[model samples]
Target: MGSVNAISKPTPVNPRLSSLPGESFPVCIIGLGLIGGSLMRDLAAAGWPVFGWNRSAHTVKVANRSGFDVSGDLDATLRRAEAEKALVVLGVPMPALPRMLEAIAQHAPSVGFTDVTSVKAEVHELVEQHGLTDRFVGGHPMAGTANSGWDATMSGLFDGAVWVITYDNAKNRGQRGARLWLDTWRRTVQMAEAVGAAVVPTVARRHDSAVARISHLPHVLAEALAVTGDMGGPLSLTLAATSFRDGTRVAGTEPELVRAMCENNREALVKALDEALALLQKAREDIASPGQDLHRLATEGHAARMRFEARAGRKVKDAPRRPIIRVQPGAPGWTDQLSSAESMGAQIGIF
Candidate 1:
């Protein structure tokens, strides 16, 4: 209900904290769901200027009681953001984006904008639709659990997680106003790193495509797997163990959230789903025909899993250090350079 700065928290001296123009830019997060709430917790804990908003006054009260500055009033929250020059983060679901963006455009049009939305391209389109592109940076933090709401939130959720910061450079193809665009990108990256996340610079389309397979498709598969396990009946349910739990972990996410994630990224998800179906169809055919070995599927799957484990382990086990690659905004082909570096597993070290 109060301004973000109304509560004073000393900024912790952290090497992970990137040097911003103002040292620490205040973050106003709208929607106090799991991702937003967890972000608020981590940023506030790290001594950054942060506050949040949720439509539910009860959720706001809970966050407030837990010492987070939160407002249930959208207009007041945006007013504070405008007054303090805060960077506004949209943490609501895809279905709620339009209304949130409209309110933001009306109340705090000049503030820097970013989001933790699961899908990036659609959000980017919506931002562009509302003429909020100038100070906007598309972002999606690749973290979260099969949980929802304020109570499900926990600090450090993004610790060592891949927090994607997206920029479609083509949008700035001939524009001279790269400073604000670049600053927005840097601010989002700084905030992500401040919460112990590794920043991956990318474009909105690529982000959507990649997440379709890695993030969204998994939810679809998990739902199918869960149902298959349930169809196995009482004995099978009783005997289900690690594999079932691991495979269906994301199936426990709020159904509406899963729908939004998959439905919003429909095109990419369909492509991913088609590929998955092809693989399954081959397996089915192999099983139906006697004497046909499942060696190809089994071997390829094993190798793929192994490769993933190796890559993921390296990322997670690596020491928390600043990004090693730097990309300048206005430089020629800088966006392409960042994308190229990202392809090689390099993160943005300096803006």
Candidate 2:
């Protein structure tokens, strides 16, 4: 996504929103690991009613002791979500998604659905298989430390992060049905913004592809970098400094979590890995040749890094103001219109 060129006036909310749940609806988070636990803390601190569920009894106990509304009983937790008309966020890892979706289907069948999973396409598929797509909006927050579990969770983890929201599985649900999805979307955008995260609307497939290059591929590279560093033996370990440490930072993440994140987006990650390997192979060939140098790789890499910095260094307040693009849910091609605007870097205004 790039900067939007068109700036317009604020669009009015869809009239249908008046018939749906109010803004004060609670949040029910499933899986109290880092992402979910942090969400529970932040939402509660911001004064939204929030509760959560974790499979581990010890984690639930720890969270409860820390004054969070988390429990070990899945059924009881989902029952409360239904009673409270909450927006449900699944924060389980990719390997655990199917089982979690099954529980959601059997327990709280119709609540607003979303997830904090690293991958989106698979989640979109599973949500449809479980008959939850009508209310589903997939999400991934571009934030996390090389940490996991309740003990590793902390507040402000999502602050200033780009929270990608996907609508790839959505359909033309007519006017009344549109209201349901729209309400769910609004609530999600509200929650993300409340936590100081920018909501970046996109389709699931694109989100997965983009993250594979910028996120999953980095994890793979980091793992390889860390292994390479170790192969240099004791002298390299003692002499390692900022560059080596920074490059391999994510390699320090829990191995299973790293596997789930990278493997879940296997197709995209493999393509990204192939591209990266090509570059490394070229560099190796250059090293073998007598007069050749890393001129091409270094120049290209430097330009790419500069582009990223130019885009990242621009603060939201520093950018030219642009109107939030509005979409009439369930209208003909409404989702398409939203997707197009998102490609132009426009934020989908909450209805």
In order, the Cα lDDT scores of the candidates are: 0.81, 0.78
| lDDT tens per residue, model 2, 94-128 | 77888888887788876787899888898899887
Worst lDDT run of 10 residues, candidate 1, spans 13-22
**TM-score of each prediction:** 0.87, 0.84
Runs in model 1 lying further than 4 Å from the true structure: 1-22, 169-176, 238-241, 314-317, 320-324
Cα lDDT tens digits, model 1, 264-336, are 8999999999999999999999999998979999999999999777667334326534335766655777777
Residue 54's lDDT in candidate 1: 97
Evaluate residue 207 in candidate 2 and report its C-alpha lDDT on the 0 to 100 scale: 86
Model 1 residue 200 CA deviation (Å) reads 0.8
Candidate 1 is scored at a TM of: 0.87
Predicted structure 2, TM vs. truth: 0.84
Backbone clashes in each candidate structure, one number apiece?
1, 0
Q: For model 2, what is the alpha-carbon lDDT of residue 303? A: 100
